[model samples]
Target: MKVVIQRVKEGKVKVNGETVGKIEKGIVVLVGFEKGDIPSFLEKMADKIVNLRIFEDSEGKMNLSLKDIKGELLLVPNFTLAADCKKGRRPSFQSSENPEIAKNMFDKFVEICRKQIPVETGIFGAEMEVYILNDGPVTFILDSRELFQGGLS
Candidate 1:
């Protein structure tokens, strides 16, 4: 599992010109499932995200968490995060999980996140136009493989 987390003032997802999901004062999470991803990563990642101290506090330090601020969350499925572009001119999605399985995983992830904060989600496998007003342009990437293997601290 891989996730790109962006702190945003607001974010929305539109499908066929119709808004599907929207959020204000929160983070936009672009999540991807790789071939070896398991269900356990969902809960861990959700906890990490909601508790992550990315928002600013009264002292102008990044000391507040989404939970502390009562912020919302926008979750978007993005299999391309698994793209392997190290060799060829074209990016390869060979590591991406099977769509059917990944969709289930995505739904489960959303459920887990929703339990912690107000959550919105882009339709999986749908063509979406995502609009984001990034807050401080702050962003971070989390990969389950690295996270579980002590590669990220």
Candidate 2:
């Protein structure tokens, strides 16, 4: 599993010109699942995300977690994040999980995330437009392989 986490003052997702998910004062999480990705990794990733000290404290230091700020979360499925683009002009989808499996994993990820904060989500396998008001322009990428082995360094 991989996630691109962005701190945002607000975010929303639209499908077929209709708003499907929206959030205020939170993070916009673009999530992807690869072959062999599991629910345990999703759980760990959620814990890491909500607890990450990416938000700034009163002293202007990045010392507060999402839990500390009582923030919301907007999760979106993005299979392209797992695309293999090393050799060819066209990206390869071999690393991406099958749609059915990926959707299931995505749902599990959302479920884990909702336990910690208010959660919003984009529809799986849908063509969506995402709008974000990024806070501090702060962003981070997380991979389960790296995070679970030791630290998210």
Candidate 3:
């Protein structure tokens, strides 16, 4: 599993002219599930994302976590995060999780995030049009494998 976390002032997702999910001030998280995702993997990613201290603090230093700033999250499933584009013009998705597995892990991840802050989400596996107003342009990538191995500090 992998996640790209973007701190945003506002974000929204639309599909076919219908609004699916939106957030006011929070992180826009793009999640990617690789093969071998499991319950433990989902839990680890959830834990890691919520605790990331990418938000700024007093004196304008990046020292506040999502939990500290009381932020929201717009989570989207992005299988392309796993794309391998090292050697070819076309990227390879050999590391992406299958639909069944990915959907399961994605659902679990949403459930966990929703339990914390005001969480918005895009339709899992859907082609979504996302509009984001990035703030501070602060972004971080979380790897489920690394989190699972206790490297999240």
Candidate 4:
């Protein structure tokens, strides 16, 4: 699993010109599932993201977490995040999980996150137009492989 997290003032996703999900004063997460991703990683990543201290505090330091601010979350499924582009001109998606399995994983991740904070999500497997008003343009990339103690299980 990999996620690109962006702190944003507001975010929304549209599919075929119809807004599907929207949020305000939160972060936008673009998540991808890889071939060997497991269920355990989803809970760990969800905890890390909501409690991450990316928001600013009274001292102008990045000391406040999304949970502290009572912010929302926009989760977007993006299999392209798993693309292997090291070799050829075209990116290879051989490492991405099968769509059927990935969709289940994605749903599980979202369910886990929703228990912690207000959550919204883009339709899985849909072509979405995401609009984000990024706060401070702050962003981070998290990969489950690097985060886990023994790597992916």
Candidate 5:
């Protein structure tokens, strides 16, 4: 699984010109399911995201977690994150999970997040227009395999 996490002041998603989900003063998370993604890491990913110290504290240091600020979350499925662009000019989607499997995994990820905070979501596999007011313009890309493999300190 791959996720692009953005610290945002606010975010929203619209489908068919109708607002579907929105959040304020929190994070906008774009998630993608890659082939061979482990489902067990879904919960771990949720825990990591909610507790990630990407928010600033009084000392102007990144020391606060989303739960500390009672922040919301906006989750959106973005399978394009798995696009393979190393070869031809056109990206390849062979690394992405099948839509049927990915939709279930996306739902599971969202359910896990909703348990931790107020959660909003873009419809899985829908044509969504996402709007974000990024806070600190802070962002991070998370991969479950990397996290489990101790790729970061």
Candidate 6:
């Protein structure tokens, strides 16, 4: 599983001209799943996301975690994040997980994330338009596969 975490003052997702999920002052999580991904990856990613110290402290230092700020989360399923472009001008999605497995893992990840903070989610497999008001423009990429393999560097 891979995720792009963006700190935002507000975020919302719309599909087919209808609003689906929205959040206020939180992180926008774009999640991607691969074939070999497992629950262990989901668990670790959730922990890392909630505990990541990206928020500023009293002294204006990046020392406060999402939990510390009691922030919410906007989770969006994005298999496109796994797109492979190494070979040609057009990106390939061969690394992406099948919809069934991806949906299962996406739900599992959302469930785990909900335990830590309030979570809002876009419809899985739906075309969505996301709106974000970024804070500090902070963004991060996390690969649960790396964490599971003890390959985090």
TM-score of each: 0.97, 0.96, 0.93, 0.97, 0.96, 0.95
Best by lDDT: 4
Residues 40-133, candidate 2, lDDT per residue (tens digit)? 7977899899999999989999999999999999999999999999997999999999999999889888888888899999999999999999
User: Candidate 1 residues 1-153, lDDT tens each?
Assistant: 999999999999999999999999999999999998988788889999999999999999999999999999999999999999999699999999999999999999999999999999999999999999999999999998888765334
Clashing pairs in 1: none
Candidate 5 lDDT over residue span 1-153, tens digit each: 899999999999999999999999999999999999978878889999999999999998999999999999999999999999999899999999999999999999999998989999999989999999998889999988888765333
Give one digit per residue, the lDDT tens place, for model 3 in 83-148: 889987999998888988888888888998878777889998788999889997777887777766
lDDT for residue 88 in candidate 2, whole number 0-100: 70
Spell out the clash pairs found in candidate 4: none
Write the residue-wise lDDT of candidate 4 on 64-152 in tens digits. 99999999999999999999999979999999999999999999999999999999999999999999999999999999989986743
Cα displacement (Å) at residue 91, model 3: 0.9
Taking every candidate in turn, the Cα RMSD to the unseen true structure, in Å, is 1.4, 1.4, 1.4, 1.8, 1.5, 1.4
Once model 4 is optimally superposed onto the true structure by TM-score, how far is the C-alpha of residue 8 displaced, in angstroms?
0.2
lDDT of each: 0.95, 0.92, 0.84, 0.96, 0.93, 0.90
lDDT: worst 10-residue window of model 1:
144-153
Model 4, C-alpha of 96: deviation from truth (Å): 0.2
Candidate 3 has an lDDT of: 0.84
Candidate 6: tens digits of C-alpha lDDT, residues 105-140: 999889999988999999999989999999989999
- Candidate ranking (lDDT, best to worst): 4, 1, 5, 2, 6, 3
Which pairs clash in model 2?
none
RMSD of 1: 1.4
